[model samples]
Target: MRGTDWLLLWTLSLLWGGSFLFVELALEALTPLTIVWARVALAALILGLALRLTGQGMPPRGLWPGLLVMGLLNNAIPFVLIVVAQTAITGALASVLNATTPIFTVIVAHLATRDERLSPAKLAGVGLGFAGVVVMMAAGRLEGAVPAMAACLAAALSYGFASVWGRRFRQAGLAPMATAFGQVVASTVLLAPIWLWVDRPWAMQAPGAVPVMAVLALAVLSTALAYLIYFRILARAGATAISLVTFLVPLSAAGLGWLVLGERLEPRHLLGLALILGGLALIDRARAARPA
Candidate 1:
């Protein structure tokens, strides 16, 4: 990956890292489906306006099928799964499970694509990075959280497939912003009926100011803006590489806690950071050694 790709990856990590907090807050007054629906729906509206303001047209109709698949894999399924899992488990454990995305991506991409074959270095790096996440988060007992843990793992696997599947848009020369907008719009469309049936937002009391703000942040910053960077990195860095953002997400979350909540960074955090960075470097070096 290039320097810009790294920058985008870190930026995306920061954006998505905060999403766990947002979802937790939103859940105070909203159900999982309601939060997921509001996220994609409002993100769609924002991205649509962004498209119109930038004079970028809607994605061509031919791309609709792909967009819908992307929506399902990337947004609807994983978003709902993660949110629901968070209801049963701490976000730190969820994040640790989420970091397995790249491991799944590596395997999926190896079987599903001609390029991006699995490599020993990549495997080592993924293992090291995952260990780093476990160390940094100190993921505790899972005595009663098996289902939620499974949900998180399932979400990570969905994300893995989505990363590989999304490469088609880049191959087809779609702009990142347009692809982002289309997927979110498709997700909103897909979730609307389910949200109506399950959440019945019309009958429920309105959420409090904090929860409402959390939902808005989830939509605008985490969903809309984050997807823009996501697709860009996907186009530039390939699926397995982009999925490495999951490893960095915990670091970003830790940084945010330290900065915003005055949480002290422990020595384990530094050790974990070192291990994660080393893993990333090994992966990059492996990529660099590959023939063009």
Candidate 2:
């Protein structure tokens, strides 16, 4: 990866890592459905205006169908599932489950297509990184959380499919802004009815300023701008590299906990970081060896 790719990788990690915080706050005032819907809807609106302001128009009509499927896979399914999972499992546990995205992506791509074959290096990397995540989170309350854990893993698998599916946008020559905009639009279209029926957002009491701001941050920072960076990186880095952000999100969350909330830095966290980095290096080496 280039320096810019690394920059965007870390930026995405921070943005998505922060989403757990926003989800927590938003949940105080909204249902998971409402939160998920608002996020993509607002992001779509913002990106739409940004596209117009930047003098770029919508992507070709032919691209909308694929983009809609991308939205359903990438944004709608995982977003809702993860949010619901958080209601049942701790966020750290959810992160650990979420870290499986690249593993799923690698395997899914390997089995479903021709190019992204699974290698020994990838197996080792996934094993090591997954182990690190387990240690970092020290998650043991699994007996009662099986359903939630499964839900989170389902979300990761959905993300895996989304990563592979999103590759076409590069071939289509769609701008990242347009791709991001289209994705959120489709997510909103698909989820709006569910949100309205389940949440009836209008009848709910007004959320305080804090929750409102949290939703805004979730939409603007994580959903909207993050997807812009997401597609840009995906276009350059491919599915495996982009999916590796799953591993970083947890690490970034731990870092934020240490820095912002003064959570103590344990040795296990450092060990986990080392393992994940080692795994990434192996993955990178494998990527370098593959024929492009």
Candidate 3:
């Protein structure tokens, strides 16, 4: 990866990692469906216009179904699950569990295809990374939050599948911007009926300025800008390099919590973070050694 690629990866990490804090803030005002709806809706609006300006036009006719599936897997389902999970678990625990996405991705990819075979080192790395996450959660005192923990894990799995499913678009010849915009548009359309039936946006409380702004931030910055950076990084760097952001998000989340939410990171947090980062490094090293 070039210097610019590294910069984009880290920047993307910060944007996405800080999203937990933004979601927490937004949750004070909106339901999970509502927040996710607003997110994909706003992101679609922005990216769609950008697409139009660049003459990309709407998504191709044959791609809608696949795009909708990707949107559900990538954004809608996981978005709701994480938000609902946060209602049951602390953000720290949630973030730690969420960091397991890449590990899950490795396993899923290994199982889903013959090409992405797992090495002994990669296996060790997954075990170590999962162990680190367990240590982080245990250190953070996760006890008796079964439902929330389940929700977060489900979110991670959804993300893992989405990561793999999204790769198929290249073969489908859909550009990144079109793919992202289509996903957002599909997510918005798919989520609306459920949001209306369950959340009933009309009945939602009128949120104050801060919470409203937080919603917009999640929609615009986290969803839109983050995806833009993500696709760009995936284009410039390899998928493995793109996955490195997973190792950074928890640390970023902890930092954001300290700054914004006045949460304190204890010694245990640092230790757990070190283990997770170390595990990811090992995984990347193992991946680098493998034959292409």
Assess each prediction's global lDDT (C-alpha) against the native.
0.81, 0.79, 0.82
Against the true structure, candidate 1 has what lDDT?
0.81
The digit string of per-residue lDDT tens for model 3 on 196-281 reads: 99987777779889878988888888888998899888877878888788888887887787788887655665666677667778
For residue 6, model 3's alpha carbon misses the true position, in angstroms, by: 3.5
Question: How many residue pairs clash (N, CA or C atoms closer than 3 angstroms) in each of the candidate models, in the order given?
Answer: 0, 0, 0
> Whose lDDT is greatest here?
3
lDDT per residue, candidate 2, 1-292, as tens digits? 8898989999999998878667767777778998898899899899999899989879899999999899999999999998898776555456656766776777778888888887999888777766766666564356646667678879988999997898899788888788878988999999998888888888988988887898999999988788778877888988667867866887776666456545444576567666766676676678777886
Work out the TM-score per prediction: 0.82, 0.83, 0.91
lDDT of 1 at 50: 87
- Give per-residue CA lDDT, model 1, range 33-145, as digits (tens): 99999899999999999899989888999999999999999999999999999887656556656766766677688889999986899878777866776675564346647
Q: Number of clashes in model 3?
A: 0
Best by TM-score: 3
Error of 2 at 181 (Å): 1.0
TM-score of 1: 0.82
- Report how far off residue 116 is in candidate 3 (Å): 1.0
Superposed model 3: Cα runs more than 4 Å off: 137-144, 265-270
After superposing candidate 2 on the true structure, give the runs of residues whose Cα lies further than 4 Å from its correct spot.
1-9, 129-139, 142-144, 230-247, 257-280
